[model samples]
Target: MTRTSLRGVIAAIVTPATPGLDPDAPRFLRHARQLLAEGADGLNVLGTTGEATSFSLDQRRGLMEAAAAGLPRDRLMVGTGAAATRDAVELTRHAGDCGFAGALVLPPFYYKGVGTEGILRYFDAIAEGSAASGIPLYLYNFPALSGVPYTEDLVSALVARFGGRIAGLKDSSGDIGYARRIAALPGGLDVFPSSEAVLDQARAGGPFAGCISATVNVSARHAAAALHGGDDAALQRATAIRALFDGKPLVPWLKQAVAARMGDPGYGPVLPPFVPPDPAAVATLVTELEKIDKAPARP
Candidate 1:
């Protein structure tokens, strides 16, 4: 096994908020620590699930600082990319300063149809601008939301140039084939598919380092089972929990699940342009999840 600190079931933790929508720093870290207790090997804070772009830089830094202060720094991966390159650099520097193990970086996403070289330069700028050494960086490949995809060529170039610092990738592109392709890249690139649903296959034919998943926020135990061993029953129940959000937005629904589990509704509130899951949808989600929870765990 590779001796990487970032490997294993990592939760893409959601930011908790006050009813007035303020970033609740204390509650946020509490929920993050709760995920670790639930079997998450690490925490990826300020991710898409966290609405990172919606929060200000201060809020973002606050989360990283809290995670550093509360948890083991080597178990933290911060999402540092921003619409502006400077913001990404600033955030990445903070991760380095905090001794975080890695950074999950989105491309400069405001403009669409960027050339391959342009996207490559964008990452190059982030790397150079970060001005910190030994801070592992993982490209956050999420074309659905960012209109940006990390091409194999670009990734290859990054690895060749930056090697250890350009540590891995998170393919939230939701395409297992694409993720597998990247995983198969030469030079031992660490690859994590967006979901734990693919863990069995990845484990069997593995280039997978592990998963960084919103689903792990609640399903950590089951997700961990899938990665540590091909526990088909655990994976089945984990996928069932994820499938409950078939038509709902994932971030809000994940927050709702966390709130329901923690008995703290504060986790359910999202930022502008996104709202909490409605009552009816929440009911269906909870019902299905509860059924899975009580089921026996065996392959």
Candidate 2:
């Protein structure tokens, strides 16, 4: 089987919420369409940016279904990773049933001390069960959150074992060295650096197929332009804009930034266990993001 190539800028889109925190279908569709219109090559729905862990299983299904309905299947990648293997398998099947191009599966993270052999087994199980589902599976390596890093050796073994079934990886560890190391692996596996800064190197012939960026929620146009044009100036601008939200707690800061852009006053509520950013922080983020928005595009 031929390797699946996922190139270009894919946006890790945010999930829109109504006053009571229910999934705002209309707003979610609007966001997806806006990202696609703004030059995003594909949509990564229900990702970290979309607060997938905060949502229940049914809610996740709803979001993926809505995204699949609103966007072209060829341009949509849905996160089907869950703490539970059964849930991951079920959700992945659902994503395929809904016509998503692929499912990004996080390793079984709830169990710590999961060795490389253990991780491989977990992925193998998913691949075996998902044979008929037909959704390509991409490993999600966000060690900071998952507590299970996809080491180079482990990644190689999985690729060799699963071949084309293990489509690619979204390396959100925020380490360029890790990203480059994974990209350097043989077999032409697709490696996606989770930031815009690496786009230049990726474009310069690294093994990276593209980027899956959370910042693209606000800077999709610039990110997409940088990826395709290979413009250093454009990439620098994207890096700077992303730097604004670098330190802020992601969920609240991202929602605040999105709300500020939309002029929505009530977009500050994050689901429980994760509070919204304080008003002062929101004000500061707004200021910072506004500066980025108004900054001149590099010539």
Candidate 3:
């Protein structure tokens, strides 16, 4: 059955790359299965961490097509946002047609300082043009990368117009207050903070649906614990693990961490813009992460 609540730890897993640096479908399914086994309630595939934009539309769609072979479509939320409107719609439509749970979409990021009307028009165009006409569309908000913030007013306007299809907003702004404010907004919007830093607070009082976190790929246990009001210490440790990469590049570190965890060498290649760090750097990071991995599980 399709999961409708949207409350749970949804991991923005990294795209497992092949030796040729292509998106590997079998490897992705294996990663998804591992995350699920570790306690991820759902998988947010093709996300920022997954480097969705790095792959061609056909590659992304091919992965989507192959996902249901091993991953459950009802539990998959594919990142279908693109810098171009048509590209976004095409990917979003693919997610819908694949029978996945939701499509995480970002506003077109081509021209900085584009008006809110243009942003709304972009969303409107996708809603009107795609097979996502009936699917859940989770707006992806990452001002740091997209340079286009999904302001509260724009969110309300989009929801007001397309409430049926507007699933909710996934805020990667790393601003807890912004996430809480959106969570507290009226209507059926489900707010998901991108990081686990705000997880405890959001879980305790905010109207948060859950967290859509990149770290959850490795630290799902703590995130799941926080959601259930379990050990804060465990959650804090998980938060600290993420902080280890502070000031360092996040995506590459995460990819390296994955490689270390899986004992595979091929998981090192990131797309062009974000090249993989040297092996010595990766070895240093893996060594650092080993301490946490070897630590005792808190009750």
Candidate 4:
């Protein structure tokens, strides 16, 4: 059956933690609200950028419930994948119960060399477990970090088997060609390339639904203008700002930027196994961002 999927600029926001390093619900809600106020069509909380895996399942769920309570649930999707099948199922069900628009699920990454069939079975459980709630699942393909790429064939197979339950995908593979091909797949899947660089193409009638991007946290205003209004200058500025993060530690650098923008160091704490970004690097990013922000919009 055909179904409408989430489209437009969705920001994968950074999670703010308290000094004790727990997911700060009030701070998280504030950031989520801020993103929507700044022109983000939706928010993808607890994704890789939001440090989902770094937080405990309870922490993730508490934050999810808090977000759903405070924000428009239809405008929020949360990362629900885990290396463990049961945990993935639990989180996916919780997300559905919380009334989220969708769950962005990564492949079971702890296992290497698990072929498509193995991964398929893993998702089969997730699909069945959350079937009662009917929450859609957006396959997250971030091979570099997850090391478990969702091949096109696998995606097609899942869609065939699960239909609307397999709503769409977030292709962080950074391969626009692959994302385009996935968007071309049957069953009305909403394929979101993980960068605002493609906003112009999408507005040009490209197949992509829109973008699910970490950098959109800072670039949402420009992205929304570009995607919804066909503003090329806005698109360029958004992409230029996004490019500034290249080669830096993505999560920390983004947190640093958010902390600076909000003037609250509480946004500065990243979960362990990750540390704060270098001050010099953050300064350089801020400087370049200022230049892009000040550049005149093309007439």
lDDT per model vs. reference: 0.82, 0.81, 0.80, 0.89
Off by over 4 Å in 1: 1-3
| Candidate 4, 127-172: lDDT as tens digits | 8999988998999999999998889899998888888888889999
Residue-level lDDT of model 1, residues 1-299, one tens digit each, is 13459888888888887776667888987887777787788888899988899888988888788788988888888999988888988899889889898899998899988887777777777778666555788889999989977888878887787777778899888888888888888767788887878777667556788888888888888888777767888888788887877677888888888888888887788898886668787877877787887788662
lDDT (C-alpha) at residue 131 in model 1: 61
- Whichever of 1 and 2 has more lDDT, that candidate is 1
Weakest 10 consecutive residues, lDDT, candidate 4?
1-10
Show the colliding residue pairs in model 1.
none
**TM-score for each model:** 0.94, 0.94, 0.93, 0.97
Q: Whole-model lDDT for model 4 versus the true structure?
A: 0.89
> Against the correct fold, how does model 4 do in TM-score?
0.97
Residue pairs in candidate 3 whose N, alpha carbon or C atoms collide under 3 angstroms: none
Please say which candidate is ahead in TM-score: 3 or 4.
4
Better of 1 and 4 by TM-score: 4
Off by over 4 Å in 4: none
After the best TM-score superposition of candidate 1, give how far the Cα of residue 123 lies from its true spot, in angstroms: 2.6
lDDT of 3 by residue, 1-299 (tens): 13364567889988888767689877677778888887778888889999988899988999888885678777788898888899988888877788887889988987899887898889887887764347788989999999989998888888887776888789988887887777666666778888776666656565777889888877877777766756677778678777777787777888888877777756667887887777798788778777875677764
